[model samples]
Target chain A: MPEMYFSDAIRAALDEALTRDASVVLMGEDIGPYGGAFGITRGLHEKYGPERIIETPISENGFVGVAVGAAMTGLRPVVEIMFMDFILLAADQIINHAAKLHYIYDGQVKVPLVIRAPAGAGRGYGASHSQNLENVFLSVAGLKIVCPATPADAKGLLAAAIRDPNPVLFIEPKALYGARGEVPEGDYTVPLGVARLAREGKDLSIITYGACVPLALAAAGELSEGGLEADVLDLRTLKPMDLTALEATVAKTGRCIVLEEGPLTGGIGAEVSARIGERCFRALKAGVQRVAAQDTPIPSATPLEHAVLPSVAALLAAADRLFE
Target chain B: MPEERLLSAYRKMLLIRLMEERIGALFTEGAIAGTCHLCIGQEAVAVGVAEALELGDEVVSCHRGHGHLLAMGGEPARLLGELMGRQIGYCRGRGGSQHLSAPGIGLLGTNGITGGGIPIATGAALSAHLLRTGAAIVCFFGDGATNQGVFHESLNMAALWSLPVLYVCENNRYAMSEPVCRTVAGGDILARPRAYGISAECVDGMDVEAVEAAARRALAPLRAGKGPAFIEAATYRFCGHSKSDKLLYRTREEEAKWRERDPLTLTRLKLEKAGWKETLPWIEEEVRRQIAEAEEACRRSPLTPPETALQGVYADA
Candidate 1:
């Protein structure tokens, strides 16, 4: 085991994917010499050269569609849409073209394209740059959405996403880029659609993912101090959302809280809460409690930004309500 | 060009024209379910451009794409079956006329969304370039697509990476009701690619030989691994944009003017001048018979079962 930053883990995963498969190419703006906006692709470009490490212009729709096309023909193209907010520019390609190709073309083509985007709040990048759009893509049928919360999961999930036959939207939490964690040495992969139980408990379940994983874990730890043990599950992948695991956890613990950093409306938290209400309703527990950002644009100011986004304190409060 | 190839191209264009006209009638008769975009007048561009393509070359087409499939040697029976929602259709009846993909013939797809195929074509080109597949891509789109952001982005990528792509812009002058002049700035469709440093040319789309010559010239450099090229085929659609269009935006005089340069008639004149005096009627009769047989087969094809709609969303995912 080795301690690595989330960014380094992602870099390692990309390196492995490119080295293992000659068809795997990374395309995005400022991904080559500049090493991307967050520097996740720093030295990979030097190792892979210009063809594999393609630095595209500010053409999100163009490159994303190109990735779809390339994936269909022969190559596996991983497109880095610098920010999650910018995925809107490429939505038509992702939703209308890439997502529906398999179904519409009747499985004649497989779109093995991965669109890597940094998502989540609390970076003070304001409304445009910071926001989690995994929930938005969850509605799309054929695409897979992966939101990894830890360094180990980041490396594993990214590797799996690249190898998956269908298109996968890999949303990296920007706030967790520099967070360090113990990652396995070589050939690591966490299967998509499986929930990672960060900390298991018998009293209550705190279901969360991406940036909110740490906050829920911290809240669960704090709740333990107050004589309550909370089960913290990190939903590594959102679309193929480990519902079987979620039902099992919710059935055992009975009490559950859905935690996320995005807005409360139509968020993944809502979906989790609704599913818990539907599947685990017979298990003795209070209603599902959700802790999420207020329904508003993430402001640039530090205090305001922190106020709108979910905090450890908020998760603690929301978890306490699950027992109440 | 030899007489046989010329006659074959002319016959293909005629087939497309007849097929489109029959599809229009079928829609009116309530036989075809969904709306259709007929490329009745722009047959030459499809026939000529497709004539330049080889076996492995792929074409990404726009919504108005029956002509593209026909020009690429697509069977009319399968295409009409697609329109009629038969199981033997290219997409197995799920994708109506707008989404026609013949992977066997390398027809990538026909997108309903405007300008959606440009980047896909670029990616296909990149795939060829990376894998040394020796395959070129031809992207067929309308003039309205020139205003799209993806159009500019794809062209820039094609130029930057020197992808083996030929961007064929069928400037049919109107996107739905809005004329290219009214919508696109400066109304110079070819200038957009020329500004992107791609070798661009505006060809007489109504003339099959001119379009063929231009496409050949563009594909030469593209085949040699040089970069992407653009050809803006100045053409028109005699019918409305879609089944919903009322044709109120453009006057009858303009339509009459474009109809005079009908691609089939232009090709007929070429064949007549080449001393094939008896060829036009014979070709027309052959195309008519072929289409009728295709329609008969299409009518005989079975409709897809409604329960199998959810069958092919993912492949063992």
Candidate 2:
């Protein structure tokens, strides 16, 4: 019943999880006392105490493995990697241990851990701080990848991820942290692997997630005036994608456009488009069009960054191609 | 130590030696898959440290972990089944010898990577402290693992948090073919942990009584929640590092010298001197029976079906 920004929604969800489950704890650099580099965990340390809200040193690998170990031993730990690029330091634990423990142990061990990382290019964080690596983890089998587009979805999906009995990579778009939305109070959850249809139209279906979701929505609105009604679907969970919804929408619309902020080559959009093409080959009127970033490191300047990443105009143009 | 405790320690060491020898034979016969690092000659470290632990206390072991698993009262048949890649094993054939686990026996897990288990052990100690379980964690690693960065980071965290963990370094003088002198800048591994402000001790790893006594003293602060402690057991590996490794690095004279201080033989002699009449024969027969049962289980255990490959990728989520 209250308006909440994406960051506030994360905080609310973490607070709710901490209150509901005593086993849940948060640990990361600058998460406690300083609230978090982005202030998402502000006031949590004071309320939950140091035991639950721990401030770890800058040992990403150590803390990440510690989180995995804790999760295996009945504790649910939410580890925050300060930047998405820094996750490479902890890749051994994330890829080798957390993602493979369940399979290697034959269901005997569960790495019920949630790793939150801020991704995407924006705010002049430069090349190092800005990179969309959802596809890097999407290829991994045991991990569940979720990128929420709205405050309400962030709160609901994060809550569900913490409670779910698997390792989840929850990537929060840094640019959307302050974006506000109407989020309900009290306990609420949206199941993973569900795609939300943000805007419904018959002309074209624009499937996207994370930062691209907002851009896609904006593009859908602009397309309405141009007499092309485009449907926008926000794929909140990327790993176990909502193939059912995608196929049904593409079948109905007969045209599709996949949008992603990462490089067009080997992006998640490729996999989504391929799957849709394979499933709805007979129903689709045109091949799936992709609106993605250019294949290069995110540039520092604003104009270059805009040129590289997918813009609302880019999505509108792609939708226009799909309709035409 | 008491006479009965001494005899029990001897029995445990004998069991580990026999079990590892059998495992080595299985590896030679091509019955075991993956890399198998046996703890054949380093039985005292496992038996001594395990004897010092309570029933609910936990231990995280290194790749050379058969002795550690057996010393903690693991079922020999199931362990052998695990090494043979059978579904009846502790990890259901998923984790072979290097990644074996028996959480029920307080053996948290054994890892293959050097120094990988240190942080997990630290986390387990932290969990015990938070849950008020009063259970101390015993982390066992080879001298090679001391070179890993996680070892230092975990020690610092454990000392800072005063978590209940006993860092046991089985300094076997060689990490694979490289001698400890070649790899370690500082000659002493115990001193490295001591620099982290944790209480440290160096003990004769070949002597079971000495290791047990040193472990008891080192674990006092950990049990009292004062902080963590470190023990560097100065031992030698009479065998090569793994099944494929040849003993080309060391001469036969050196191997014979360490074998002279063999933990099983020393414990047997100690038990005999303490008036235990048939200790050696009884332990030998018990170990023989265990080896036979383990071998039979290994032969009879079913291999993991290929269809269940994707199972447990996530815990029913």
TM-score of each: 0.98, 0.96
Predicted structure 1, TM vs. truth: 0.98
Model 1 misplaced stretches (Cα beyond 4 Å): none
Q: Chain B TM-score of all predictions, in order? A: 0.98, 0.97
Cα lDDT tens digits for candidate 1, B1-317: 68888898999999999999999999999999988999999999999999899989999998999999999999999999999988778987888989989889989999999999999999999999999989989999999999998999999999989999999999999988999879899878878998989999999999998999999999999999999999999999999999888899999999999999999888888889999979789878888999999999988889988988977676565
* Candidate 2 wrong stretches, greater than 4 Å: A320-324
- Consecutive 10-residue window with the lowest summed lDDT within model 2 chain A: A315-324
Over B1-317, each residue of candidate 2 has an lDDT whose tens digit, in order, gives: 79988888888888888788877887898878787888877899998999899978998888888899999999998898887777778887888888888888988888887888888888878778777888889999999999988788788778877889999999999999989999999777878988989989899999998999999998887899899999999888877898888788889998898899888778777788878866678768987987897778767878868787765666776
The number of the candidate with the highest lDDT is 1
Q: Report the C-alpha lDDT of model 2 over A85-126, residue by residue, as the tens digit.
A: 888888777887788877776676788999999999977777
Give lDDT: candidate 2, residue B104. Answer: 87
Residue pairs clashing, model 2:
none
For model 2 the local lDDT of residue A214 reads 87
For the candidates in turn, chain A alone yields TM-scores of 0.98, 0.98
